[model samples]
Target: MPDIVFKSVPFSKEDVTLALESGVDGIITDAAHVDGVRTLALCDVWAEADMPSVALGSKAEEESIAARIASGERLVLAQGWEIIPVENLLAQPAVAGKLAVEAASLTEARLAAGILECGVPTIVVLPEALSSLKSIVAELKLSQGALSLGKATVTEVRTVGLGHRVCVDTLTLMERGQGMLIGNSSAFTFLVHAETEHNEYVAARPFRINAGGVHAYAVMPGDKTCYVGELRSGDEVLIVNADGRTSLATVGRIKTEVRPMLMISAEMETPDGVRSGAVFLQNAETIRLVRSDGTPVSVVALRPGDEIVCRADVAGRHFGMRVQENIREI
Candidate 1:
């Protein structure tokens, strides 16, 4: 692909058409033009022109970059991809600590290499010239041109495969929602609405599902996905089963009193007299189970033989439970 540098102009529908005819692969403009350009659906129009556009700001920041990406604008030119205006990517331990092999330099050539290593990605930049990184920048353009054909082929293959897999999984999940205890639960007992909801079976396996509250409990109706959570009021949730089939559920008010957790009671054979090994606790938000030494465990995974401890804590400023493994289990 040929590289065509653009400058800001009084763009109109006519201007965009002319740019395509003139063989412009990209457009470079100030942030001031962004709003007007977007109003024209610049991104979509450019795609019709068989081109991809980039957004250039005097300075690039995370939020702006994220916005541009969401707006279908590809390619961002800033001090560096890692160097956002408000935050230094290098200052972040996560980025700085990354293996040097992965760090892309500020120059064109290095940036191109970074893009190659990053898999033929798009880089957006402003029309202004950077004296410091010129040589590396040139290299990046060269590398991109050289690798375009091969990269497109690889991308096409991957896209087709991924799309096929997702379609199959979605269909399977939708079919399995018929009879399943798709729910979010605490340790004591599986939460259920006694009257409005009840247990059912699929292929003779017992399944207790409740469509309750402004919030309802459900699992995705597919085997490939495993997310069990409460659906908020007016929220839509998917119910999935072991075979990857799914169904959709719309939540209404709680029809009956809701229990908070799944209760499991078992007798412990101790060295002393047989003790009644039973524990009662509300779901995750109330009492978090933790190891004595303070390790987390999955609340849904507590078993009859498993040794566990409880913790008091909160996440996102809300109270919740933390599960820890017991010494015996360790």
Candidate 2:
């Protein structure tokens, strides 16, 4: 993971050095903060550090893709509203680039893939894309786990749990753990954490949620903990709760339904068959079960023996409800 610096903020190199001692991988920022003679200059000051730099386009239409190059920022975030064509995005070689598409549905994921094919190396999906983790995991071919180090970089072997030696970059993880490393020590309002144990990620620290009910993870959904494990249908996924108790769900099926929503069919058989045949089920809360008549029954209300197709819309919907047993872990 890279260290991210926002404009008009105060940070210290000692703190960044501490992050390097901790295990951060890289850094992110724009031209505004990188030009100062402050402590941030020492932040990722080492050339050998695994720290990759990303420059953020100031405005959507700012034509200065070279700002990062001029200011020494290596990686750049193509502002979401920016109209840089494929040629412009590929023309820049000073930085490894990522695109911000803030997906609220499946249409965004498909569009993201189309953009990737156009040459962007990275894509950030918004909160809406969290529900479609399986689809995104598959689409991105993300087969490894990620670990986040708050504010540090490493260059040597370090010891952990059992005589096991591991390498710590600016951020370090076992490479297969679904963990997150957060940067920046300010803005308590935008921090985020897994809503449940069954969530795609287990937070490294507590995240701040806003009055609007959106957390940092939801706000910059693309800037998130990487997913670990092999993605397949029928896998029991677990999302951890705020209290740390995990929720469970089975991957019943995966199919492209409407543009942004990937229909995930999960069948839940309760002991007594409760919410079966209830009407009034709407788009997200509705569950469809195959009945003897071969017609689908809508489980709008809580009932047993009612099996419904859980629609995991990539366009953005409530998909992380880790409130069950036998769930899977991201």
> Which prediction has the highest lDDT against the true structure?
1
Poorly placed runs, candidate 1 (over 4 Å): 1-72, 75-231, 242-330
Clashes of each: 51, 58
lDDT of 1: 0.29
Local distance difference test values of all predictions, in order: 0.29, 0.28
What TM-score would you give candidate 1 relative to the actual structure? 0.22
Give the worst 10-residue stretch by lDDT in candidate 2: 208-217
* Tens digits of per-residue lDDT for model 1, 206-267: 12233222222223222111223332344333432222233444433222333454333333
lDDT of 1 at 199: 28
lDDT of 2 at 303: 42
